[model samples]
Target chain A: MATHRFDPNFTDNVINSMGPKTSPRLRQLMTGLIKHVHDFARENELTVDEWMAGVKLLNWAGQMSDDKRNEGQLVCDVIGLESLVDEITFTLADEAKDAPTATAILGPFFRADTPYRENGADIVVTKPKDGEMAFMHGRVMDFETKTPLVGATVEVWQASTNGLYEQQDENQVEFNLRGKFKTDADGRYYFYCLRPTPYPVPDDGPAGRMLQLMDRHPFRPAHIHIIATHDGYRPLTTQIFDRKDKYLDNDSVFAVKDSLVVDFVERKDDPQAGLELNYDVKLVADAK
Target chain B: MATHRFDPNFTDNVINSMGPKTSPRLRQLMTGLIKHVHDFARENELTVDEWMAGVKLLNWAGQMSDDKRNEGQLVCDVIGLESLVDEITFTLADEAKDAPTATAILGPFFRADTPYRENGADIVVTKPKDGEMAFMHGRVMDFETKTPLVGATVEVWQASTNGLYEQQDENQVEFNLRGKFKTDADGRYYFYCLRPTPYPVPDDGPAGRMLQLMDRHPFRPAHIHIIATHDGYRPLTTQIFDRKDKYLDNDSVFAVKDSLVVDFVERKDDPQAGLELNYDVKLVADAK
Candidate 1:
């Protein structure tokens, strides 16, 4: 009942409005959210114009979002919220030295129904003239037992040299640079595709405008998106970065993990030169 | 640069990522936001499922929003952030005894082309069969001078007895229960319309689903929405609640202020009985 003083932080009033059927967990979450948000507005002494600007930005994000795009999620990514949640939710405890590979954002570009392919197959349906193919191979293993995870499904996708995911660039064929492979008996999976390139998060919308206002570049590091999964093990969605990419340290999405960065070795005069990248992934067993 | 320990609260890392050209005000605002949002997720020990649920909820809100509706804003309103911002931004310093009338949310229903009618014209184009007419009049005044603002604009709109605005209900005549009037020489404006009714906020979308999860009712109280404006004084957009409405204390939007509540006197068998509801508005002069 905050009255007279115009103290709209009637936190109790709002909390009290909850009905008896409300979930205790939701109550706790809503309580914390209301307190922090109220404090944010009050401490900032946020003006009408500023508040409305935030509202309009969110509205713009909603308007710009659709099947092939998610401006709302992009807002979270650029603000570091998505990465924070990923870290908090998926990061293993420090007590475990043999943790699984680090998790990364399942960015907006991921699409379902990826074509399945055999080992050492190429995912680039039609490689660009300017693109150079890279050899990518890895072993998926069980973390605690240090054994190979036979028959694990490994899905991979990457941007073309132009930095646009296939779905975003109409000129590219559907499912270009995207595929899934079942690991061999030794837990090995391999594929050939154009190397991932640093790219901007879509900036034609409100979230992109935020980067513009921050004077921050929207480029994510050159990284291959991967998902390794097998029954009885936790599915890991992650990105492995080319260590040499300029955006590694300051990824627009704040999603880079030290353990997830690997060198795309260079062998100038050899056939395999600048063409090979080996990344082994470990999976944490799902608690029985 | 939080690393190894999975301390994603990399507050400085994200803050430092801002470009040198970022506005100082935006930097401060973002720093506060990042800290608060991160603390919220971390303190709650947020899980992947829970975080994803939030992301999905926001996505649903964005997808459900368009020209006729703004689910993102509804999310803010149901959470009380909009009201808190309005209070903090518009509430004058404690020393100003003659402060302007309290402000309220310019809810999603406001339309730009409100018909300009003479002082006593009725806004109800075609009255509902079950509706009872209410006579509403208001005066606009300068707070400090306590003088009438002749020719001030008084715009009013309210929900019909069925709890639907014109645009939301196709069956209703256009501009029903909405009109704008210029004050008479005495700063008086009047219009007849159906009495306001308590109504639920749009609950089919994510914001409404949130209220359902909280076991909270989505209804706002019976009230008349008004905006008083003149050449020099600050415009006051506010709501005057009917003292007898049950939802007055638990308004879904957290917008009911003590200073803005009024009793809608009920008239006996007499023609003029229970019909008179007069409210006066005060506006602070815009600072030079």
Candidate 2:
């Protein structure tokens, strides 16, 4: 057996141990992070067994993640960490009535290298028998000048009406419900695809268990994910949530921003289109 | 793109969302944990990419752990989370001069079902050519009564002189340097094994990279781990640290305590033994 002593300066000792070569940002980040984590554990009198349980849960999350899924980010999302961080980073401190549309959680399902499509092209590779046709048209404009930003690229993705992303459904073809469209001379982008439906996050992993413990539902409101970029404007990664979805107010990831919510309208002219959304994007200039 | 609004009650919202069915303790723990983690992120104004990188790092740590090694715990160890928690949980609020000896981290290497050995038995299976033999004798007693605790089990384990625990080295025999011995009627336990040498934590993983970034060394000082348990008393998991080790003050795990330090003396009687150590133990009865 051994004796014990309280290190009155345990936090300082750890923070100071950082090598002089460490960048100031890294040191500051680690110092704050460690202080918070240590304070939490100490204040709670966290036991070794309880701490080990957390380690095991994290391990389970890692084991459950792969190219098609990321349980790691899901853990953060379910805990409100991803949303909180999104708020902290994307929200301008200035109280500017308008900035570029606020960003949203990219989530774990975004796929890179999606195929580019011409305006009005369909991203639906294999539409469900009961799926409704939906069209979205939008213009990208500078927030301050209210002027068009020509030739912007709007990369878009969404789950199917059946509530599954391409990677999660083998019936859907490669890059299903995903496309990148370039704005026309009017700075207007146009495309059509199946309307997305609310779906549950993968509920077999650690986040699922966490939700179960918290007695919270695991559903995210139906939404379209977008990454809009122009030559001199700040790039945006965000989601357009369906205003009618029941889960919007209680989104499992807490990522619903009222501005990002849009109501679907009945298609008036195109017999092929069952619904339509007309949403415009506002962009902020890049920081110097 | 859509609109945005700041939930002034973001932190409180998250804390209040916990279900009524959740155990009070779990709710409290989660609330505190989420508060600290959220406050840290918000205060730092961590960018999305930086937050994602941290998530990826935690995932990497999880991926590096398995049945034989746990990088999750190691991450906590190097950052002093585990040590801080140990101090908070095990350190009594009262200033009692005499209590049971203190505890140390039961690092990832501990295995169940270790073979039991008779008193004076050896744990070293295949010693290194330059390895020195060492013997340890210990007595377990009641802290308040100063009376012997007979028939108690003292479970001990150590890395070989080569600084590799059996599980980490394929060349080492099964359960090498691991054994449990029962104390005699006098509350004394005895065993002989190879002297442990300073060893580095597995540094090929995320924790390793963290240490590298922090400009910190990864080596823990030489020490023997023990878990002493008896019926009707609190169990004790602790360490006997080699006093002469250079890293004693800067142990990589921050586990070194003044009372746990012991000097190894030259063996006078046994030509087969290179060093000898005698450490006693004290136990506090379990609380009612």
Candidate 3:
């Protein structure tokens, strides 16, 4: 066999050879990826055992993901990668940073084709409710003009008080705690559901094990997911966090933006014996 | 919900909370990983779409790996991460850097329990061999003392001229071109097999697609893998490359070290119609 030496130019040689004819975008992305990944391994002086362990982790994460669960997304979340990407992609102009509603991660639990309900309709389809009832009322408006956006579709979903989404808990009815509402003439939308409560993300997979190994909790702050869309306006996907939830200070997903937090007012005299939450969403107009 | 602000401290808060009680090694690994991943996203201004693309790639890589295939390992190889890790983990002391045999990646194709063959025995188990025959002879010695090590187990395996290992090509017999041999008293060992040839890595999976997208070729240079172990010496796993191979300078896996390259001498008068190769291995002793 021929004997060759180990030179420092190995990385550049590999990069140059691998990206000769790729599209400019792909070339740029691959170049950055190669440099960062190579630098990361060298800087850490990573061992073969560590590399193999990572391989196993990735394999486990892939094998654990399915229609109802996405461990890869969870991996990104646990490492704060998703949040960083969101910050980079959604950072608003200095003057409008606080004007528009802050965006958060579109977590793995979201589902499409949710049933649409009328304003003030109850979305808790499960029988014999086990958690405190709550009403969430909100308005959707154009960011700059503050004009109500009538006919805006407000899609909402959240985990039950027990910390499990409807799809994750077999006992809950299909589409439980999930529904869509259309804004009325005044750009108002309302729905009745259980109060949001802090709940642990699924801890049965590699992602959960990763959290355990890191000495970190898997709980996300009590929050309601919202995706609002209207013609001529950019879609807004965010979560409204309950300020009192303990996990807010250390959300496992790093998705807690201050502007996305709000109060859940206790109403002891209400017939529903639950809390009331009011939130307003401001969305940017879609660029022409 | 309570109106909270988007604090810039979120990343630090998560990092601090997640690593308090972990082992020092785990803490360091996690800390560096979190920081680099976050920085990569932020520096590149990674978009949500781009992040999702990454997630999809990871998912595909994971799902594509199995008993006979390892897409994750291939992903690392393509990104130059495995080579970097190997470099860091196996780097020799400055004084002896050039004295010892160089190490290479233990690729996904390596399998344990290969059958042992006697010295000068042919490892090719297939009938009517299509490629020219070759003989590989080498000696094992201590790096500093230059003393031969007897009874050293030298395991060897390589793809056929068609660029497929026995396991990857079912038409070939089990353990074809794979054997383990013990060195003689003089630390000499020899085996007969087909000449190695450059072949493309498996491209039917996500890893292959990644290479195609990046316009990168998957062909590794013509080479043979060797793993030698002895009683009082550290095990060495490496590959010897054929210097004349077209892909020598651009091995798809980035595993070509300068010292691991060698000549495949053609013997025109040999009845077997093959080439001869000679390589000497220098091993580092096990720590006392």
DockQ of each: 0.70, 0.67, 0.58
Per-residue lDDT value at A131 in model 3: 83
TM-score of each: 0.94, 0.94, 0.93
* Model 3 Cα lDDT, one tens digit per residue, B73-132: 998887778887888778733244455788899998888879889998888778435687
Cα lDDT tens digits for candidate 1, A1-288: 433354544767777778889898998888888877776777667776788788788777776777888888899888888888787777533234555678888888888888889897778886787877778888999987879989999999999888898889988898989999998999999888777788888889987899998899999999999988999988889998988899999999999989999887643553532587888889888776
Better of 2 and 3 by DockQ: 2
Q: Per-prediction interface RMSD?
A: 1.6, 1.3, 1.9
Model 1 TM-score, all chains together: 0.94
CAPRI class assigned to model 3:
medium
Global fold similarity of model 3 (TM-score): 0.93
- For model 3 chain A, give the 10-residue run with minimal summed lDDT: A1-10
Query: For candidate 2 chain A, which ten residues in a row score worst on lDDT?
Result: A1-10
- Candidate 3 or 1, higher TM-score: 1
Off by over 4 Å in 1: A1-9, A92-98, A267-274, B1-9, B92-97, B266-274
As a whole number from 0 to 100, the lDDT of residue A40 in candidate 1 is 75
